[model samples]
Target: MEIKFNDVNYKTKLTDINITLNNSKINGVYNYNSFLKVLLNPKLIEKGNITIDGKVYNKYDPKVIAVIDKDMPFYTSKVIDEILFYSKIRGYKNNNIKEDINNLLEKFNLDSNILKRIGHSLSETEKYYIKLIANLIYKPKIIIFKDIMSGMDYKNKKIIKKLMEELKEQGVLIILTSSNSNILYELTDEVVIFNKGKVLINGSTNDIYSNIEILLNNNIDVPYFSLLTYKANNEKGAHLFYRKDVRDVIKDVYKSVS
Candidate 1:
């Protein structure tokens, strides 16, 4: 899923330019279906093309859909049912899909029995839906996760993070772009800064965080924890990354106070 851009130039007037994406990960919860549609039909990539597994996906091809539920009015049961039906017919295992749907239904306190009547059982049907989605993801060397954590609570965000880690471990080239730098840093190993139709920097998350001046110049805000460490370093103090590191530092500070 390596992307190599050669002699690539974009127009200033165009806000969205279609570029070839090699193993690019898209992030967003609502954009799941849209992404899937793009994967299945390459023509949909007119805004941006993706080269996956040696196949060139241009605009108009269906993309991969990473389903994310945000308890929105638009995310109606009917819509979920429809997506499940289509996915099932297309030989997609319905396990994960069904589980996610049921989880959403339970959260909303909706009528779970009604869904069962429509071939969505808590037992077999749920597993089927998950299997269907899993089938869709079979041998996926490149994955695009669109706005995966939008509107997700902390608990749900943790779940998504675990899933992301699993995907990364599976050797899937994951590209996730999000407005939430905290979540992005937590989830992705690499970061690509984009502003006003330009790539400001591409590097590891830690490297990007270390370069606060570059981030500020590009209009990208540093994550809060990174800012905290940066301020401490300015005061000739120790710096750290993970929460545990911060916690350990706090413990040392408490010991000094005592």
Candidate 2:
């Protein structure tokens, strides 16, 4: 999605702006207090008027919460509060929002009992809540994860890789961006190199690795087995790219020696 601003004016206390999403006008009004509130505390509430298929929405409607998945409960609660505060203005009526809340909590294996006691770190719980909401709402076509495996140990990383492959098979666009080129070489079909915000190279993992200088410059280390092959190939005056090529070279060397 592309965003553009038009006829924008900013003052110390007042700002008028227009925001376009996917080449359509999504926000046109300016409220300094609301803008400041959002800027100061982004997680306090969900901002911006959302329009799906050209229909403008109040953004606190159940359908809106359903679509956004109430991922940030605090923000959702704020939205609920705002709705209640302006209930007379919007002609809103109270309903059983608890059912929806319960359904959301159930996805994360959370219950009201646990929520009340809440000895766990708020950040961790927030992450779980966000993930649950994201999964519940807007099953996105493309999901990009960057360096998620970096801090994880082997066992946890393996689980993540397996989950990624499963998501890939389910037709989700899974893009894993990592500095660990060896891991990417083992797991991904393609590799893309970025330098100073520009795409330096993009090709099959094997193809990109053929240029060792580019990989080294980008801090992408070659795999250990590949290093072995490099040494063997240098002794025989041969250059090979993929592991299969290296195996064939080794087999040829064995045949000649035997």
Candidate 3:
């Protein structure tokens, strides 16, 4: 499905933004409130004449998409039951779901016992993985993940990163949003960076992440590596992080010295 935003300006949310997005590539939008405003009202672009797969779509059709946020709570006694509820809501029948539940647990590296425990008692990763697994039951054509890495440590980020890769491989258009620049750099194919009420730039993940000055000027949290590379360039005229490789950074350090 392709979503086109044509010459759109919505109150204080958007300003003459025009972009076409479709397919399985991971796209990102950075900036907390801007991300929410866009995600919450995707149909708002309809006023500017939106089309899905080349046809006009005027109504709100969020069913074709699933927006996963960590703060969204599942109201169920047990974890497995909650998963079932969401799956059914998405049009998947029960029909012997035990094996499916088990598979999901294993896929997310979650313990089987969590399935029988309270839905709300699990850790952040557990909740996110469970919700994602549930969303997959009906196989949404598009999935939007927001703020899933807010409080995650580096190790947890890697784990979630692997899960994101799996999702990307599913042939679904994926849209992600995070305040953490590292998460966007690690998972996104392309990104749209917003400052205040307008888009600052829309570029490849590496390009946007490598633009340390612009990102810092907008007060966006930049990846540590990008910052290190920018500082290195200022100190030694060696643009190391632009290559976005740790080995390149080391090699640049050597060249700078000798």
Candidate 4:
């Protein structure tokens, strides 16, 4: 369940890049969607190689990697049709697709009536969830999300976070890219920050986010929690632990004051 990029070069778009990603953790690739393109199509790599579990990714395998991106095309008009089409192609030959789709819709808290509506007519959040279900129906080993948290509300983001945890528990490799640093800090276990087709930092999310100066130097926005923790510790002499939730930091602040 590990994917590696060994000195991968894609024309001038991506320079000599080396990354190792695996299951049991959400991997965040900062401000880069082109990496997703290369993984989806390894032939784009002019030099070096991309591998899954030590094997080169020379061919596309829908069962191996599935992407939930806005750019993913929808051929069918109806939501059900779109899901069913991908399901069939991904090899749901003899399985009860109706039951499966129902379960997926329910799992994501999607309404059953939406299945009959036109795919293009749904809201962005709804469409995203539908795409998620379509991809997850096949149980792909890896899932890549491109700019998924950008426009999402807090509730939908929470849903996605919970879903990611569930996927991690099922041993799926989750690679996500987002402009939002807060989302990345809250959701990802590991992050690889890229700058000008090269990796700036690749480490545990907590470790990377703990350094406010590095993030500021790279022009990446520091997550609020991280920034608050840093300011409290350094500026106010209030020793505080870095936490994903603001409330946890508040509790620490209370403890410090008391």
**Best candidate according to lDDT:** 4
Off by over 4 Å in 3: 42-47, 94-97, 153-155, 239-247
| Candidate 1, 73-135: lDDT as tens digits | 222234345546545444656356667666655543356654534333433324333333332
* Model 4, CA-based lDDT: 0.86
lDDT string, candidate 2, 154-238, tens digits: 6545655665666566655545545565666666666555443234555566666655656556664666556655665667665
lDDT of candidates 1 onward, in order: 0.49, 0.44, 0.74, 0.86
The TM-score ranking, best first, is 4, 3, 1, 2
- Alpha-carbon shift of residue 4 in model 4 (angstroms): 0.6
Tens-place lDDT digits, model 4, residues 28-89: 98867668778888888999999899888898888789888876767889998888788788
TM-scores for every predicted model: 0.59, 0.44, 0.85, 0.89
lDDT of 3 at 238: 70
Superposition TM-score, candidate 2 onto the true structure: 0.44
Instruction: Give the better candidate number (2 or 4) by lDDT.
Output: 4
Best-performing candidate as measured by TM-score: 4
Ten residues in a row with the worst lDDT in model 4?
Answer: 91-100
